[model samples]
Target: MSLTHLDARGAAHMVDVADKPESRREASASGYIRMRPATLALLAEEGLPKGDVLATARIAGIQAAKRTHELIPLCHALALSKVSVDFELDSVTSCVRVTANCRLNGRTGVEMEALTAVSVACLTLYDMCKAVDKDMQIGDIHLDSKRGGVSGDYNRADTYTEQPTPIVAASAEAGRVPLALEGERTPSVRVKCLAELRERFGVSELSVPFHELASANVAGLKLALKNQYERFIDIDDQRLLCAVNQSMANDDTPLTHDDEVAFFPPVTGG
Candidate 1:
């Protein structure tokens, strides 16, 4: 199928949604912030330097949904009717589960808005609590369901796992950013970055949701994390540089179980 964002000459252009019928659209998304038990307690006791972590994160999520067009290119801006952000504390796993819902009467679905809300909320939580736990993780940001569109409705019945395996392809997973960091986020093999990629992605780590790495090399891992975890719809994998262990490894480099691979984009300086 032809890409909607491209013109006849392969130039970028926004698709006109003006002709589409307006409907009451709503979308729901969710993710988690995993931190140390101590950090969770800190927030619980209202001991963090930040006044209220959940309140701050809730406001940030709602604001982000409103400004989704600004952060995401080619996304049509819509007047959102409602945005709801909620957090549930799970002390057993030391995870704060964030769920966001966005609604609007518009030509397009509110999936992006909902996803953006969850993302910013998790990030805001990390930012406020990072002072005590720099290793906090933001993970599994995915659309739970969406309503009112030509495509009909979608809901993710299977989420998380007793095995903690990554959710593979299903249409509902579109645009979900799985930027998970360490601290028991998943049971499957993980992909992490080194100094440079960590600094660029603004997180020291993230993981792809693949059951087995198989013969896939380092480049494959980059694509999984960027396309799946980072949720950058327009990411070009070729622009990324990878390294294994403490040495630089090319995309052709073979991968193995429990191997540490680092990735970053090429730098150009004057």
Candidate 2:
């Protein structure tokens, strides 16, 4: 299908939704932030430096939903009727899941608003706990569902499933080389640089072989990039953001050959 944000001449422009009939629209989005067990314990006990982490994050999410149009250039401003942010703590995974919902009677969908809420909430959680847990990861931000839009409704469960796919073969075959060979001909990780990182690095995408890294982890990946290119020397672990397969990741997060990795600067305005 054609993208609504593009005109027939393939130039970027806002889609005119003024002619569309107004309807009550709602959207839900979710994400999570993972941290150390000790950090989680501190958070549970309200012992962290930041006071009331969840409460602050919830408010941040709600505010983000209301101002999403200001952050995203093409989004239409709407009079949102309701916005809510909820947090669920999971001890087993040492993570907190954030879910946000937005509703409004308008011509446009509130999907971006809901997504912005979740994203900002996760980021706020990270910011609050960073003093004690610099290795925290924010990830899995996605739209869970939407309703009342002209495109109908959508539920993530109805369209998506988590299935592990093999990313590399065990050994060589024909012209292909095995990742197990290590230094000989290791498989590569697909790396993407987003936002300002793309401009700083002068390239949006590149690949790094598994063998080039000092270790199979996020830190290793960053170090390898810095070693290969002098301009990457400015990459800072504490300030930079990272994701693996669209989920937030920390420096110690392990990696395998052929994994999709992204690095970007900390986001602002949700």
Candidate 3:
């Protein structure tokens, strides 16, 4: 079973949030759907018998948020405080962008709720439109960010063009060689940001110094980081150390980046 599905044993269940305190929590998730222009014309003309496409999608998203625990076995049954859905049309791509924002005050955050809402909305769109547009693709589902927990705030620093939303990354045991590089390393070797690192390595945390980054093998890290950096910032070894050491974890939504706006690819409804 996927580690995401349950505890390590996969028998006795939900993660214990008993030690955690209640706080205001919020999560935003987004999804994309793309279809042919002819199907877009039909949707624009209300040619589908499904009535209002966006409205139905919104309802579906709301319903899905409430059922996240049922779908994901180990997720806690959260009493959602708020659920909101937004839709935007893209004439250029003949698609819609579906976003779901979920909020709650509890021991655990509502990231799963937000993600479930967006996924269900996209599925609903696919369900309503698939008869006419089987080619529609649902892609780029990611946690934009999350807030109000012990883990603290996180933000994606990369621009949207960097590539698909990063999942997570982490250093391998073998990859964690001593920081012994002399002056040979670049001012800053690109490291996989903590978010992508986590999904990739299944590690909950990482520790880095504020000095120049020294890794045994940073080739893959450089590639992943390059995929996200827009321009480049020239920093000395001290500054590099500070960034790696103080850099926040990737618990927040991946879409909430600093430079360019991050959006899931376009979504559509039949």
Candidate 4:
């Protein structure tokens, strides 16, 4: 297929929609910002250092939708008729989900505006919570649906799959212990330090024997690393974000052998 934003000579250029008939175009996009439970609690209580995080993020999203053309090149500016940003807090995942909807009676669809709004809203949430939770993550930004234009309407499928929670069994001495599933073997935990943390550690990835950890949880691994390396002495837990098996996790999150663990500072982007 020919690229809409490229000239026949292959130079990048904006698509001219002057001849096309204007239609009522609408688009919706969604994303999420994951943070610590404590940070989420603070936000729920309106006790964060930044006042009214949700309200600030909503306004930011609306503003971003109106100015999407300025941020992204080769995009046509449209007089958006309506834009709305909404937020939902999920304590189970300790995250805030953001959705943005944009509508305009124009030749081109408003998908970019909707997507831009969602992205900026997620970033705003991260910014508002960064002081208390440097380990937050913004991700899963995508277009949920679009309507109007010759391309017809589009709707995204609900394909998101939740990560399986770790299984645990009661132990008389250990209280609760993660038990390996039948036919599964967990021998070690893979550790990764990302971004600046990777540079500080001088290594991107390492492995820790599950048994070697003082305890079989995220906190135990952090303590073990601190005890073994002087570089970890200055690292603060509140400033570090963690993921276990590709899912956001907290210090008390359970761990088993062969689990992938990632440590990194908070991510930033528009």
lDDT winner = 2
Task: Assess the local accuracy of residue 30 in candidate 2 as a C-alpha lDDT between 0 and 100.
Answer: 95
Q: Name model 4 segments beyond 4 Å from true.
A: 158-270
lDDT of 4 by residue, 1-270 (tens): 123553433334677899999999999999999999999999999999989999999999999999999998767888999999999999999999999999999999999999999999999998888999999999999899999999998887732442323322221113322223323344667676666666676556656657778798998888866665655675555967778875679989999866878777764322
Worst 10 residues of 3 by lDDT: 257-266
Whole-model Cα lDDT per candidate?
Answer: 0.73, 0.80, 0.58, 0.79
* lDDT digits (tens) for residues 1-270 of candidate 3: 022222232223467788888899998888788888887777777787677887898999999999998997668998899999887767797787888999998999898899899999999988898888889988888778788897786444443444422222233344344222333322222232222223433343222221322222232232233333311122111222112222222212122111121111111221
The lDDT-based order of candidates, best leading, equals 2, 4, 1, 3
Deviation (Å) of 207 in candidate 4? 38
TM-score of each predicted structure versus truth:
0.61, 0.61, 0.58, 0.59
Error of 1 at 52 (Å): 1.0
Cα distance off (Å), candidate 2, residue 162: 14
lDDT tens digits, residues 44-108, model 2?
99899989998999999999999998998778888999999999889999999999999999899
TM-score of 3: 0.58
Q: Output the better candidate (1/2) by lDDT.
A: 2
Candidate achieving higher TM-score, 2 or 3: 2
Q: How many clashes in each candidate?
A: 0, 2, 19, 0
Clashing pairs in 1: none
TM-score head-to-head 1 vs 4, winner: 1
Name model 1 segments beyond 4 Å from true.
Answer: 158-214, 217-270
